[model samples]
Target chain A: MGHHHPGSVSPLRTLTAAVRHHRDRNVGPVKTVKLPRRKLDFFASVLQRFGELHAPVARNGHFVFQRVRRWSEARLEYTRTELPPKKYFLPPRETLFRFTPGKGYVPESEDLDRRIVLLGVHACDIYSLNILDLVFNGKYPDPYYQTRRRNIALIGVDCIPDQRCFCRSMRADTVEQGFDLFFYDIGDYYLTLVGTALGDDMVLAAGELFESVTPDDVAEYKRRSQERHQRFQLDVEIRDLPEIFEMEYGSEIWEELGAKCLSCGSCSMVCPTCYCYDVADETQLGSTAGRRVRTWDSCLFATHAAVAGGENFRHSRASRVKFRFYHKQRGFVAEYGRPSCVGCGRCSAVCPVGIDIIEVINRLRGVEYAETEHAATR
Target chain B: MQATKPTVGIFGLTGCAGDQLVILNCEDELLSLVDVVDIRDFLMAASGGDEFSTLDIAFVEGAVMTRRDEEKLQRIRRRAKALVAIGTCALQGGVPAMADGLDWPSAVRDVYGPEGDGFDALPARALHECVEVDFSLPGCPIEKHEFLGAVADLLNGNPPQLPTYAVCTECKMRECDCLLVDQGRFCHGPLTRAGCRARCPSYAVPCVGCRGPVPDPNLGSAMDVYTSKGWSPEEVVQRLRTFGPLPTPVPAGEAA
Candidate 1:
């Protein structure tokens, strides 16, 4: 269902810049390393010099993104990680301060000063993280998160000629500019496109490391990315997703998911973009030593919103389940013009219950079964 | 610092203790709160003071889970010039109420030792269990910001203006594609209250109905949303049943 054109690399391409500012050193824009794929030395050099580089590192039977000091530790090619690359921003829990008898309060917030380059980020994770950026960087920007974000740079790599991926369905197959720089593994050398000024500065700074993309490099990157797009396993007609839910607002599917839902909040936890949180005040041993802290919150919690008059707004597991999906898929996008779910596939992949997001979205659209058969079941 | 201040007491009951934790989270404005409100008792936080005079303002959390708790709540109500319910546990019975399922006896039996006759509880009255509650601020643990807003409002001689709308409305305003329509996912935003600003949804989490049902929520529409998500009718009713410890068959501000 696609074609290969001679020069239309509009969908995907690799380009350098006049003033690219990629950072290789922890302090400056990235210093490029233009070595062959096997030249692990280049990678080693980057990680070694930085002392801190976080990329997709395998761990716990599932691929988890972690800090990497060497090339061997980095896993460039992967299907999906157990967790999306969200922990990089809003950590699971963070203490805001410590307070006691009110003589003085202590703020224990820390910002990671060491620069981190996130490698092998999937488009979905990119999309999801973008939503997070929009949120944390909203009206009142979160100083804690912003400090780290400004120091870090995102490096996105396309999924290896797909075994299976639903990023396209979730509208995340292609990067619409979130990364400071993008890398498409094109055989010998990475076809890199400097995205932000930081990216351009880095690329320009490393004039010797990265070669300008010739016509051939651009062509190869396109061919490979397109092939993957066509072959990608999940095909969701997402344009009409909102309409599907609108029509099925009375559907029985919600309760079904709810019934099986452990309400464990695992799905939300693994999600790259799920950032709902709760702020708490932790007093030290005395009334004086405590600080306000923030931790991840789940909608599945039954008491999320109940009033004194004894009214429980969303008390059902189904409702919790429903609210999570609607908020991500539709509500969030409508409000922020950003899709909350970056299609990182972490939620379904790590779900103990085996609820696949792709499957759920398809079902929402009434994937199969005629009206009669469906009606009979109902 | 301000010269004089109003006396306020904050308390909690059976939920996850999230509400108390939330208010305690008011970091920047905390010292100010401590200065302004003379907190007499906060079961979750402070060891508590005993003078227990008429409180200018009383902040209560969690549902009435015990006889002692009921008595404590009544005392708070009677003694406080103003009372505010903070959190789902205090406002709506919270999760414990979900287990009630109308058949209070069976619900109790489901818990306790056996024969529905074990450590006698005041026969759990419809999850709210007992006591008269004044103002209500819902949320698993009241949103720290919202809790502050409510407190601040009270200080300004105006109660916090909580959103009485459904979660779905906020979701829509957030421009989140309907989860049910876009991705066959079930969400109770349509029937849940606003105020949390639909945080869960934007975070990519579903509405769990922790906020409790909205005023005159369209149970019928909510059930229909579930159907589209491929849930069975039985599942829909079962879901709705869990949230309304004491079903709000009528609209908010209307009769039971």
Candidate 2:
């Protein structure tokens, strides 16, 4: 269960194949190239011609995706950023439109056309963006999200999985598409995979900086990929887990977790796929005009399921907690043919009370667990 | 403008009056607020309105710590169609209420000495204990934007929507590293209500729960998180009680 390979019989398999097929069909064949370690800075400098550059930078003793004036400021080797790259697409707060008594509503177009080159993203993050694309680009598409998607260029980089990372188990440890360029470290050189026409343009613009990948480079890339695969310390079984969630609908574990759950909404906020939001209108003082706005919302919040006339659909903490898990693991499977979680483990790292996803899933699968072993301290 | 403007009053009781001060601190929006709403009675900023006239909305701050405070609150509730309780003092019986079970006479004597004999102060209680509160905006001193937003909602004939999630929501949204999880620090962000925008955590300072507890605070697990970090149960409870009473979680057997 812990050592499943990519394209295994799991919920993520179909979606992963779909994404790869879509990219291969649209962008011709993926062009594999190599750039020397020393020329990385030179390559990044050339990327500035396309758009403003952003990369992971140290902030308050943690990493965050920030705009960098120079390539030296970007921490390409950072483990994880506090917030996912989703902040670029679905912002924390955004004004949809402004309304006036006589003029009606005017849509806001601020920052929609700004181009950005987001650098050093991990595979899980890029995959999460693909999931978000499915949601935001569906039947009722969001113009704001679609515009941002078009403006921002994703440049993904390979990462070493930390103790919290479970991307390998979720099949998100490696990405084949949804990024302009994906770089894998192979000692002295980076084996880059170009997935889009824009990526080809970036390489062509760089001239001699990028070199063609030889047979030895391909062998070295395979060796490093295998090494990275073995480094994942955490794992969760995804096969038949959605059915298990359905069977455990009446389990006492939900009540116990609810009693222990803080309902802080931290997990959802840090998550890459939890994209629920709440919309509201703000009226200006001494005027009939106002602006409609939306902010990130979580199903764990008491008010998330609340309605008018003092009625709450999920009034109990146990029910709300159950709803969050069921929605991600079961409900999403029915709708999108896959679970929504990318298994990035940001939720595990950010939960103040240590409500880990891996632990919960393992418990639901009837694995025995002791209190001291699963304590919140670790 | 006077024909359509709502008559509003601001009142204070026993706390630091910091919540009212936050309103006064809204310098840029203060004139705009006065332009829209008729400032009938605000002793801190203006005092020319008819104090006896009926008020459409009344903003009350501070806790009820004296007999006079109770009477004033009852009067304000009677004359106002909508009464909003602002700040942790009025909503959750802040700092002053921390001495509820302690010896009051000796405690007062320790501070005021001989002058304390004539000081008749009742135990600190929240405004809801003395009168019906229409709405509550909780913070040590209510956040300026929250106060302004609530007022704007009331003026627009809509119920004010306050965030029900914990401070960790905003803290994560601001991309602040979790003080409790990342570092071995004591932060009340998990149990404390949001709307302070994770201000303390953004500066790398741990939250002290000045906004009081969230509606569904998991005290058991919060204690577990603290204890696992080497804090004793007594230490955790004492820290939680610093801002207000730690709400007791309903027993699992009794919970819905």
Candidate 3:
């Protein structure tokens, strides 16, 4: 029930264990591999030791999670990945069942239900997983997702001091639970760390490959994560959030975004956390055989909020845009007790029209409310 | 199928029938559902009845905005074996929930001049404003698969579970490049629950969080993420309430 992780683990020790864990299963409790200034070969070692290895790799001028067979394939120092590591658990399109109408739901299929070990997950993404676990594991429990989740070996990496990160502000800088193992890419050594029983087991098997990390290293990792928060040089104060919302209930900013937004949903599609989806049942013409599938959806599209009677509740792009903004910040806070945004900045990075959430927050905070209010008075 | 057959009744009050439509969209499976249970009363479907039979489940859609609707929902609650609040209207009041902080009379006046005397007025709130509900399925229209899952589980002698994870979970699962990383589009996926599998993201759009918030979503972090991008607190708040709700804090250590 509890994540129960001891403090943070050293990145160097974590890598050492990863390589040792797979190379020789019988190796003395290989749970981590502290890469102490090892070149790309260390990464290759992990790949060779384990059947496969996953890490962030630069592709088409963007970073993405890919299979790293050799160390050269790994891009340890990068800006950001196109998609977060969460795909390893609950994929975009997964089959919940195969069915026939008269017989009812068949409830079994595997597309994204394969065993995968995810690596290089950032803290913001790690927190995103916790959210996913809550959803898929809650109430009835999604067996498909659970099976994949149970099979995964999460390996997290610290946000490099670059990449314009704001994890500190969003608290994505650190996660108390979710990852099985974590890695902090220190200059000389990649601190291979442990976060769970399985992770501990992997580390125990690594033998001398992993040693007890020094306290200075842990403090340095925390320091780097914290210091990097300032490097982004962009932020919303969060103090005036409620008050800003009060007046922003009817702002012109929403219409502005709507006018330019094509409603393509590319932003949501690429984000590390947007999860709206639609479900439909399909079958061949003459047969009763059919299966219900859930596909992703976006509130930005007019049809997203449309109902049976042809009435669109959040009809206007402004309203729809505003609704999304509120849900992550104010709406979710009131309903579930926390703001839903992880501050990954994926939305800001992927918009075709360049609608920045940070800018919206600033406008709402009266970055110019006073000037606008005065002009209206005049 | 009548051996201890589950008698189910469905009712809608005010707000968009999006939730009802989601159920209706269950088309192919609808017939199967009918075969498994005796649908006692469903106002939107051809299967409603006035026999006033005992009910095992009452799927309530829309917010209880009117007095008559309130009474009807209360009666249904009394008669049904279980009560589920479907859609944001029933759960958090949907778009109508937008009226929560405002005065109804003024709102009516704003939309209609003093001559708009045809409008009826009453105290309003989410479904909780009128009756007790056992479960709530958020989103303007509750996700159909989730609805199906809950219904199927209920029929199988189990309760349905709703996802409390933020929308970010599904967004990442889509393997979509984080839109905010390369562009400046703001999204609400991190704060919104993961019940809906981030359909908007797949279509290359940012999430507007129609399904609402996950339990214990981190507003501080969301704001920090934005602010780090030079967004002010007001801007973050604006984004949080894009759906008409001011992001609130989660209960202590509660799992989303």
Top lDDT model:
2
Tens digits of per-residue lDDT, candidate 3, A1-378, equal 111111211122322333233321112223445656564354446434433567788864678888876667777666677766655654555444557766756554344334455667888888877766555555435555555566566767776434335455565667766776777765677777667776675555554456556777777766775555445544456654755676777788776665545454556666565656655444432244555555555666556676767786886656777888887778656755556677787777665445777777877776742312322343
Kindly report which residue stretches of model 1 are placed more than 4 angstroms away from their true locations once superposed. Answer: A1-35, A47-51, A100-106, A161-164, A204-207, A307-311, A369-378, B1-256
Each prediction's RMSD over C-alphas, in Å, is 12.6, 6.5, 16.0
Query: Which CAPRI quality tier does the interface of model 2 achieve?
Result: medium
Q: Which residue pairs does candidate 2 place in steric collision?
A: none
Per-prediction DockQ comes to 0.04, 0.67, 0.05
lDDT of 1 at A85: 67
lDDT of 1 by residue, A246-361 (tens): 78777787877765554545567667777766565544311234466665556765545554677777877688788888888778768786557766555664343455667677
Across B189-232, the per-residue lDDT of candidate 3 in tens digits comes to: 76676767778866778887677766544454455556657677
lDDT of 2 by residue, B9-79 (tens): 99999989899999999998988998889989999887775778789999999999899999999999999
Computed on C-alpha atoms, the DockQ of candidate 3 is 0.05
TM-score of chain B of each: 0.85, 0.93, 0.87
Cα error of candidate 2 at position A294, Å: 0.8
